[model samples]
Target: MSRIEARIEDLGLALPAPMLPPGNFKLVNVYGGLAYISGHPAIDGSTVLVQGVVGRDLTVEEGYEAARLAALSIIASLKHELGDLDRVTSWLRAVGYVQSAPEFHDNAKVVNGFSDLIIEIWGEAGRHARSAPGQGPSPLDVPVIIDAIVAISE
Candidate 1:
């Protein structure tokens, strides 16, 4: 296994199967040594693992898990595109959308789920700029959706 894959194993995390876009957009676009990954929900073969709005239907913890799942899907998609996790040099940025009640303001904390996992797997290379915006609702009513930009080596 590649070092990156070994790290994931050490964390007891397996990348989920990469998901195809439900719509017409491409799941990943590579250019200029960077990969732009589309937003992914916490889904596995059309099953939405975590749903509903935070602070209402789910707790902050559940939202965190959902974001983590979404990040895993993103990593899976990356692996599918590059054929190896070791190709990744660094994460550039990530944006997470949180389906939340109006009173739920801890959106950044929710997004940390993704960030934390990335750092855990890639060490310093996984650290990146991030934004977590809370929305009233999302497609399929999932609790979280995440997208990322990563730098990759040839």
Candidate 2:
């Protein structure tokens, strides 16, 4: 296994299945050289894992963990479609929205979870521009919502 895959194993993580679309769109689409993955809830099975606004009922650290779980969900989606995380070239972009109290403004720290994971997996190539913002509640009332744009090779 590649070092990244080995690390995931060491972390005791196995990417879960990509969620089925709630509407009409595809879960992931590869066009040209980019792969666009749909937004996913931070859920594990029937339970929504994390909830509440950050800086309110949730701490930035807890939000960080929620974001980490969201990243893992994306990896699961990638594995489902590509069969191998090694095919990913770079994590081109990420758009993260954090559910937080109106007074809270530390969205970037929460999203670092996702950012850190990409860097851990693809090294320098995983680094990318990201948008992390405090927003209204996400679907399923999760603490965070994340989506990714990745570049891959066939």
Model 2 C-alpha RMSD to native: 1.6
Local distance difference test scores for all models: 0.89, 0.83
The C-alpha TM-scores of every prediction are: 0.97, 0.91
In candidate 2, stretches whose alpha carbon ends up further than 4 angstroms from where it belongs are 1-3
lDDT of 1 by residue, 26-140 (tens): 8989999999999899987567778899989989898889888998888888888899889999999999999999999999988998999999888899999999999986999
Task: Kindly give the stretch of ten consecutive residues in candidate 1 with the minimal lDDT sum.
Answer: 42-51
